[model samples]
Target: MEKTLVLIKPDAFEAHHVGDIIKMYEGIGLRIAAMKLLQMDERLASIHYAEHIGRPYYEPLVSFMTSGPIVAMVLMGEDAIHRVRELHGKTNPAEAADGTIRKLYATDGRKNAVHASDSPESANREIHIFFNETEIYD
Candidate 1:
């Protein structure tokens, strides 16, 4: 089984859509390997999004992420990385498909509901950012 990291962004958390998002994943047979609700500090957000550090959206992205508590989780299942990203849809909710999580709950590009690891390598790295050995279940 593949394991991927997912982040229920602050906007979605503030809007109370965590259940809906999690259900969508579980509904598809993805297992929640690890989960937690916590506020992200600037340092961690920086580390999580390090690749996008100099991009135009980086500043506001960090600010929004650190603004409130977020739901961080590790989802495990076949093709979990790709599946979760597909479920999350486009970065901009406006461009997301009709049945996607972003389409249903996202407010805008900045607040586009969720984040998922883009690849297997990224999945392993991202999962470690928020979860430890004891935090995840087989």
Candidate 2:
């Protein structure tokens, strides 16, 4: 089975959409290998978004991420990385499809409700950032 990382961002968490989002994933047959609710600090945020460092939007992105608690999850299934991204929809909610998570919950492009690893390598790296070997379940 493949595993992917998904984050219910601060905006979505603050709006209390955590269960609804998880339900969407589960509805597609993805299993939760691990999950947590935590407040992201700058250090963690920087590490998670390392590639985006020095970009124009990096600072604000980090700031928003650290602003509140987030739900971090490791979802397992076939083609999990791609599946999660499809469920998450476009980065801009206005451009997302009608049934996508972003279309249903996002407030704006930046606060677009969710984040998912875009590739297999990204899924592995991101899952490690929030979960260790002991945290994941079969």
Q: For each candidate in the order shown, give its overall lDDT on alpha carbons.
A: 0.93, 0.95
- Per-residue lDDT tens digits for candidate 1, residues 36-127, read 99999999999999999999989999999999999999999998888998998899988999999999999898888899999999998999
TM per prediction? 0.97, 0.98
lDDT against true structure, model 1: 0.93
Which residue runs of candidate 2 sit more than 4 Å off their true CA positions? none
Winning candidate number (TM-score) = 2
The best candidate by lDDT is: 2
TM-score between candidate 1 and the true structure: 0.97
* lDDT score, candidate 1, position 73: 93
> Which regions of candidate 1 are displaced past 4 Å?
none
Q: Please provide, for model 2 over 25-59, each residue's C-alpha lDDT reduced to its tens digit, 9 standing for 90 to 100.
A: 99999999999999999999999999999999999
